[model samples]
Target chain A: MHTFADPLRYASRMAPTKTAVIDGNESIDFAELHRRCRLLAGGLLALGLDKGDRVAILASNGQR
Target chain B: MGVPAAGLVVVPLNTRHAVTELKYALEDSQTKVLLIDRDPGELADCVNHVILIPDAYDAMLSAAQERELGVDVRESDLAGLFYTGGTTGKSRGVMLSHRNLIANAFHYMTTVPQREDDLMLVMAPLFHAAGSNGVIANISGHWEPRSHWPRSIPRSHSI
Candidate 1:
């Protein structure tokens, strides 16, 4: 089954340089967003977090 | 977003809720990690780990390796646990699966005309379902912060 990451993966593949998100003066392309997501996921994994684990994010809307 | 990509369930807490409510939601969901923008006072003890935004959050991302995308996420796997506003009664945790959110995205995109060059202004808090789903619905579109709405809206002549 396709997860939420599919669109990003597909977008990055189709247009890596396409701007995916823009917050204020900063903006990231599809490829960069996908890359950061992977790196963040890897970081979580390195913390021993696995499937079914619960993660909470409390931050305002922004590029970060 | 990264949480679900890693095959973990996300429990987005209402920032406006009181400490009592926050404590209840966290305990009810049994959250493993809490990534907050600031100190949550006594609420910090509710989760196993608390990663502060910007600083600790950035360090966490930079320190670890990249995770392989879509490892073992099933359609039925729980993606998030959204808590109700408790306006009617006690707050309840609304369980949503990967398929559910993806379906919502598809449904939203189908109903709303989204173009490749469209720019979406995110005015609502990302913790809200509508807010988060809005972002997911038009993944291909450029997302601008709400602060830029005043100047950005007029530029989008098509809208």
Candidate 2:
């Protein structure tokens, strides 16, 4: 659908080893990030979250 | 990453907001879940779930299977809701769709492209839309190593 998620959807295959984000002392590669995000989505769904549901995030600008 | 991919709307609350402001956002957005890095305090009572980072969040992800984000999500679907700083009277929620984010990312990339060896240092808090301006270019071309999973990264962390 060419949304913001599209890049991540194909990231694992496009450049898995490429570095995506670097936080203080933490370096995350594409593969791990993608897997985690997908799992996160599922986890939220497992918790009974539905489409169009709202998920709020309140935290500093670190690599969460 | 997950929410937008799965057609859910992500509400990035301003970290600078007070308890009442935070509660108002939660109530107004009808946030079903709250993913926090610090203690939510009373904010925990506002959402259906309060997932603390690096612990409850990791557990939740590991127990669940990978989600199929593209199966139902469309470009026009609302991806995120960025709240204003409230300097202009009442804080408002800026509705941004997948298309909007992707386009913005492309604009950022076109203006300031990231090279293979160039790494982007994220300094802005993600609650601000400008902080996540480089997501598309930063993550679009990466390939997975087909290795272990991560317990720290959020759906929209950094990228």
Candidate 3:
């Protein structure tokens, strides 16, 4: 029953303060990462996106 | 991450491909929204909604309220449509479900092993699966020590 998001979910709850992603100038913890992902999910949902819809990501590295 | 987290499918387009190929992929995949990093130029019109990565993306996130993620998605549901390089012929959208990707992540982590503190550097583009290979294991807290690798890498990578 695992999904790609399961890892993030587990890490955020298990090690909320641990650094999960380190960008160029800053680093974010799992809790912060989880919060952001949730917010981003909310934002997309507010945009009228629905389940099973396709969302394409076109970008170079370090943009996320 | 957000798209799939929201129960939506993500289609990562290869930046190296021609605009025509990209357009073809978008159309073929039936993508509804495009979250891009820079000025989309002609690609702006490809999808119904185009959200700029840093600027508009941040704005959207800032205005966003937390919501339940993956409430309707299942392990077997499609998570992403990875476009092939089309070296032989035309590019194809490879359907990958959430379970498939999770399993793949586990496989990758098992093969190479990863430490909780290891800072991975993605040598390939994020559009490729290789770029996001380390993301799951890192988050999953699987430990495998190479012992001799550097702690930091040049440039930057995002998961």
Q: For model 1, give the RMSD to the true fold.
A: 7.3
Off by over 4 Å in 2: B141-159
**For candidate 2, the TM-score of chain A alone relative to the native chain A:** 0.87
Best candidate, lDDT: 1
Which 10 residues in a row give candidate 3 chain B its minimum summed lDDT?
B146-155
Off by over 4 Å in 3: B143-159
The DockQ figures for the candidates are: 0.58, 0.64, 0.67
Name the docking class for model 1.
medium
Per DockQ, the best of the predicted structures is 3
lDDT of 3 by residue, A1-64 (tens): 5565666676678788987777788889888988998998888888898799889998887737
Q: What lDDT would each prediction earn against the true structure? A: 0.79, 0.77, 0.78
Error of 2 at B71 (Å): 1.9
Query: Using alpha carbons, what is the TM-score of model 3?
Result: 0.89
